[model samples]
Structures are given as C-alpha cells and as structure tokens.
Target chain A: MGSHAERKRRDGAQPSARVPSASPAAAHAHRESMPDGAAPAVPGLIRLQPSSVRAAAQTPLHLLPCEIQHNGPAAVSRFFSPAIRPGSSGPVVSFRGRSLHGEEVTLPSGYMGLVLREDKSEGPEDRTVQAIGTFSCFTLWGLEAPPGPNARMHRALSWPSLATAIHAPVAEEDD
Target chain B: MLSHKKRPAEVHCDQWVLVAPESVTDLPGKTENGPVFTRLHNPRTGEAALYLFDTNAQQLFEVKAFHEEFHSWFIGQTVQHDGRLLLVTPVDPLFMVLYYLIKAEKEQGKFQPLDQVVIDAEFPSCSMLLQCAKLRPFLHHVTEEKEIGNKKFYKYSKEKTLKWLNKKVGQTVRALKIGNVNVGARVSSATFVPGDHGSDVKEEDYICYAHGLISEYIPKELSADLAKYLKLPELSASLPEPPLKKRKVSDGPVEAEEDYTKFNRVDLKTKKTNSKMTAAQKALARVDKSGMRSISTFFGTKAKAGK
Candidate 1:
C-alpha cells in the first residue's frame, strides 16, 4: 500500500537537464579547459574569467563591509520572484526592504542589483535580497553587490555636497 | 665608447623617440638640474604626440607611479609597432573617471560626490554627463543635495566608489585594444617620434631615458624573478599588522577577580576537611612533603625507619 503506482510513475520519469550556474562563456570554457589534476568541473568550480578571478582571489572576506548574520534555518516560498528587469541601458533592480509595518517596500533607486533564487524545494529560508553596489551605479551592470552584513546600510548613497560640483541639471526622460 | 653605454636600470621603458642623449641637455627647457621636458606620444602610432611637455625624470617616475597609482587599471604589457614601444594601458573613459575619483578621494581624505570629483579632476564634461544622469544606470549611491551653511554639498560613499571602479576597470580591460599588436607582447609601439629638435642626440634619449633592448643586459634570472613578482598576487596596501586592540583597564576589579566572584573563592590557607579543597592545597597535598613517601613508600617502609 505504501509503494503506490503513482510513486512508481514519478520515479520512472526522466530527470531534468543539469542547469549550469556559471556564465555561458565560463561554463563552455570549463568544459574545454579541464586541468589534468582537477576534479570534473561542477557548477561552481574554479572561476577562469579575469574579473571573477580578481573578485574571488583579491578580495578578502574581512574587507567587505557587509554584515552577514545567521538568519536562522531557511524557510521556503512557492513562487520565484525576479529581482531585476532588463532595461534599455542596463538591467534595473529594486532594493527590497521591510518598512516599519513589516511589509516589503521596493526602493526606487540607489541600489546596484538584486539576486533572486528559485525556491524549488521548500527547505530553509535565506536572504534572497542581495543589494550591493557602488556609490555611482550598481544597477547598470546587474552585478552582485559585495557581501554585506546588512542590506540597508549598503544600499544608501547621499551626496549633499555634490550639488556644488554639478554644472548641469539632471535630465529627465519626459524633458 | 662601449663603456659609455648605460645599464638597463638607467634606460626608460616608455615609447622612446630614438634621439641622441645630448638633445635632452641642449633643450632651453626648465631648470637644467631638474628633469628635461619631453613629449608624450601615442603608444601605437608615435605620430599623435601631445605638446604637453613632461619631465624626463617624471616620465620614469610616472611609469613607477602609474604602476602604483593605477595598478588595478594597468595590464603591465606593451605592444611594439615599427620597433617602437607602446604601453597597452587602459584608455577607457570610465577608467579615466575612476582614476580621478580615486585620486581626489585619496588626496582629500574625504568623501567626494561625482560633481566635486569631476571638477577637482578637471573633467567638467564628465561632470555634466553625470548630472544629466547619462551614467545613471551605472551609479548606485548618488543622492540629493544636503545644505550645510550656504554651501550645497553631496557626499559620495567610499565603498560605492570603490565597487564601481573595480567593476569598471575589469570591464574596460576585457574590451581594451592597442592597435593590431599581439596581446601580451614584450613591448608596445609608439605613435610618433619627436620632431628632431636639431640636436645630436639619439631618438631614444629624446623620448625618455630608458632605451630598447639596452635593458636586455638585465640578468635573465633577475628579470625572470621580476616577471614572477608582476604575476604574483597584488597586495592593495602593505597594511602593517593591525595595532593590537587596546585592553581597556579601568578602576574595575581585574578579570580574575570577577571570575572568583562567579564561583566560590577557595582559600588555600583554610584546612579543607572535604574532597573539594582549593586547587593550590590539592596540588600541595598531592606532594609527598614527608620525603619518606618517596622510594621508601615503594619498599613499604619509611627512609628514616628503614635505617
């Protein structure tokens, strides 16, 4: 009775394709350039891109200003919420934060990008929102912000004095 | 004449004009004792020479300075064109802006917004573009003005600037090109040779001090070691070991005293009648003070009693 026909049918179904997590270039290169002694290239093995190599190798964990605290065991949600939009100039992403009401509020600007994860298995909860960017513009490149201890502290960029140096007015789309 | 030949260290590595050494001395330029003024040319063509005269010593200094100033932007390889040298340095607009941003921040030791930095770096055009929000997509931290006294100033965050610069440099490097010269070649080509200043000097001296192939004399082993150093992981700063965290000693009782209060303070002088004796007494009690408990104890007799 426990081993029903439905379970058997599910078991017999074909497994889904193995999706690579790395960029297509990196993934393709990984397959082409396998080191003799290294293990078979898994999804997140060695990063070969110069920029990625620098990011992984040069930046020590301590130098990053992000605060990463243990947010208890993870929880799961049914839907996959996308954090970014592919716009004309670049990808735009909203910085998600909890207002005083504990409701999620999306900040309009001043954030680099968002990192969204598909909640496939109803496992643990995670910090799905990774808002990290430069003082200039993180949204342009759709880059993962440097790991931060907290999203709120890292997302803010106020330039009160910058007005003096600015010779031109901000151009609006409608104008 | 062979003895007059200079060592590789004395030879500059930038695009040389192949002039005789005397042309540098003959120029009616700045102070004679100081560095002689020379031309900065396109690394590829050596044809588009900038009239801006830079000091010869400064050129040598700038190469090292560039190594230090924009180490992140520098690719450290050169391409040769028609036997002249050109540095395949990053010429990206983003790179230039980032350089100015970092330079301004470092010099002022304060946060500088895009506008302020553009003015300080003399990139007024870039400043206008920034205000126009042309670079809006790339920027993350810019905000509205905060009025202080009569001045309206904007503060840029260091972390954001740094993050942006790092990403820009990386992206720029990926698409960087230097004419048709092969990537990773030993030396790059120069665009222009200095107009012969009617001096009896070699073109190499006219451009800058460091000469080509003349540096080949550098021991191969030393050069190889240097090459290894260039490839070795770059340390952003030679950070001295962080100063030891200062222990704040106040009028409060010592930490040991606090521990004593946490538990029952055992007095060693007290003759504990139970098994829970003070640690000092326990250790002392474990010692055979009688001395007779030594070898005599093994023999089942005291040393004095045995005698």
Candidate 2:
C-alpha cells in the first residue's frame, strides 16, 4: 500500500508539470466541466486571488507597527529595530541598512528577523519603511529576493500570525 | 512820476472800459464841472497814476453804493468835486475787485464762493483797473441758495462769476511795465535778452553737500546760495534749547484739602460723639465699624461667667 501511494504521489507531481504546458483547448474543455474554473481544493496550496495579491503588493510600510530602539551605550539616539533599508524599490531581504548612496550595506544581520525595505516607489527620498519581508527565517535563510521591484511578499504565507489565512473561506465568484 | 515822452493818446471810457448803464447817464447833471484829470495814489507801490474823470465820475452813487454794500473803499481815489468830497477814479475800481476774484479762483483751481467786499479789501490797488473794467460787463454774479432759518440767501460764485465776466474781456492784458507781475498780467512774446549789465540771470554754482564736506572749505558762492536756499537767517540765533522750560515756582507747595464726607468718616465721628453704649454694645459697635475682633473674644470665659 505504501508503494502504491508513493507511485500515486510521483504521478501527481508529473501532472503538475503538464498543467503549465496544457493547450488552451484542453483548459477550455476542463473549465466547462468545472464551470467556475476554480482550482481543485488542496491543503496548504491555496491560490492567492489576483485582487488580494495586488492589495498585498501595494500595502504601505507606514501602516505596520514596528519595534523602535535606541541602541548604543547612552541610548541618546534612536532608530527602527528592523533597520530600515531606505530607497529600496520594495521589501528586500537585505541584512543591513542602505547606505546614504543607496547601496545596501554588507554588514552582518543587524536587523531583527523581519526586514522592512523602504518603499521608494512613491517618495524616493523618504526614509519611512512601507513594505516588509523576512530577512532570515528558519525556512527562508539565504533565500534570494526575486528580481524586479514588483515582487511582493505574500503576508499569509510569510507571517506565522496569519497562518489561518489560508483556511479562511474565499467568496465564490461566478465570473 | 508821470511819463511825458511820446505819451500815448488817452482812449475814451467806452473804448477802454465797460460802459456805465444808460440809467446812470440819464440822471440829471449834478456836478458843474464835466470831468477832470485826477491823480490817484496807490498806497502799495506809491505809483501816483492819473486818470481823466469829470464831476459825474466823482459822484458817490457808484463808489458809495459799491463801498457801503460789499466792496472796500481803499482802492478809491480821494477827489474834490463841486465842494463835495468823493472817492472815485476814471478806471473802474470794480475792475481790480473782479481781477482779484478771478485770481483767487484760478489759484485753488476751483470755483469758491466769494464776497465782493473781500475781493475789494484783499486787492486795494487797481493797476489793471482799466483792463478789468473792460471785462467787467461780461462777468455775472452767480446766485447761490443757502438755507438760513427757512430763508434762502443768495451768494456770488467767486470763480464761476469772474470767469464768466472775463470770457469776453479778451485774455490779453496790457499794462505799464512795473517789474512785479500783477494778478491779471500776461506774459508778452518778448524774450529776455541779457545786456551789458552783467548777466541778467546769474548761474547757480554747484556745491557738494555730501558727507565729510567741511563748512570752511565750501566755496563762497555756494555757501551764500546754500544759506539762502535753506533759509538759515531764521535759524541764525541759537536759543540755548529754551532753558529746558523751567517749572514755575510760586508761593508754596499747595496741598489738596481732604474732604471727610467722601469717606463717610464725618458722619461716623458725629455718631461716635452723639451716641452712648454699654461695654458689650461698644465692642459690637467696634466689630461692626472695624471688623478687626474675633468671635472667640465674645464667647470668652469672662463673658460666660457674666451671663
């Protein structure tokens, strides 16, 4: 029975590769059977809606509550705990603050687990952090950021607090 | 002094001045002598000018009436006619009165209500009397209505009446060259030519009155002009700051008398002298008057023992 289940699992992985290469005619026929074109319900594989994805992408950093700290011997100066990487296009999984010249510093992880890259897409000069990403998580250490400023971190998948977000019911859309 | 060399032939009254009304001419002759060349004295310039007038001209009908009513008599010449004293002149004195009225109107560039008396008094000499007389008939007194106790009073329009009077009098005025320009004098076309008598117009010297200029170093010519320009003569006497306006010291220090009635202390003193009271009543009265005693004093051991 274990050997048969393993074979079924391998078969499922093969069909996923075929799903991308499927012809439009095949998708049309398959869509007619489902009618709604909804993906088959799967655990932990919930497809993010395009509207939700857009909302996540456009979320501003100032909206997030962050830990502020005054480090150094006297604690006279203050700075954000997750060192703000100013002038970045979006949330970058950088380990250090951005220099005055806008180049990311090569310092060791001075930031907390979370990294908030300053959203310079609006006001390029502003230092306020707008979007967020995990700099180094247990599962995401050494993970490279995707190319381009448009790459957005999915909050439901990235944040532990939002673990139940995938289980939340999606309102069925007819069109 | 009268000029006798190549004297210009004297023109008749009709040619030189506005003719008198026919009413004046129709009057019966009262003076034996027709007219005479009378000398009129001008108090302002001391010009003893002569004018030809007859016995009729010396009569006070025109002069006395104008003088007693509104205009001044200072402009009239004193003349003796037929054993009677008269203030008269051949050139109508009213001409000068009108010229001044017109002049005052032009100065402020607005029509002003004027009294005929004020015009005559202000300009007493009539050098341009003949010129003004010729223009006088054209002038008319504008009646202005002023409410006084429900009655409307008529006043002459000083500027408007004079302008209207001189409208036909011809703008050109011819008079003797008297160095000083009169009210009605017009500029002749003749340009001033500097003759051998030095420069008729002296050139003003240039002087720098800027900072660091020394008074002693200033040029003599410029210093004179600067002094004249600034009218320094009036400020020549330094008045030592008027001695700082010393306060007037009189007999003694004056103290204002205090009035006890203002504080009602007089009535309180009278009440104290007139009324008698027991010790308790006196204490109560003291408390009422001064409010300085404590209520604890009234409830003391001695007062309770007495009760």
lDDT of 1 by residue, B1-307 (tens): 0122221111111122111112211234333332211122222121111111112322110000000000010011111011111111111222223444444555774644556765522112233224322243434322233556765544444544433333332322222211111111111221111231223333222111111110111222322332233232222110100000001132121211111110111222232543333222232222221111111111111111111
Where model 2 places Cα greater than 4 Å from the true spot, the runs are A1-175, B1-30, B33-49, B52-94, B102-166, B169-307
Task: Provide TM-scores for the models.
Answer: 0.19, 0.16
**Per-model C-alpha lDDT, please?**
0.21, 0.21
The CAPRI-style docking tier of model 1 reads incorrect
DockQ, in order, for the candidates? 0.01, 0.00
Summarize candidate 2's per-residue lDDT along A34-145 as a digit string, tens digits: 1112322220011111221122221111211111111112111133224434344434333223221111211122212222122222221111222122222211111133
**What does candidate 1's lDDT look like per residue over A78-114, in tens digits?**
1111443454433343322310111122222322111
What's chain A's TM-score in each predicted model?
A: 0.15, 0.16
Residue pairs in clash, model 2? A61-A130, B34-B54, B35-B54, B36-B53, B138-B165, B139-B165
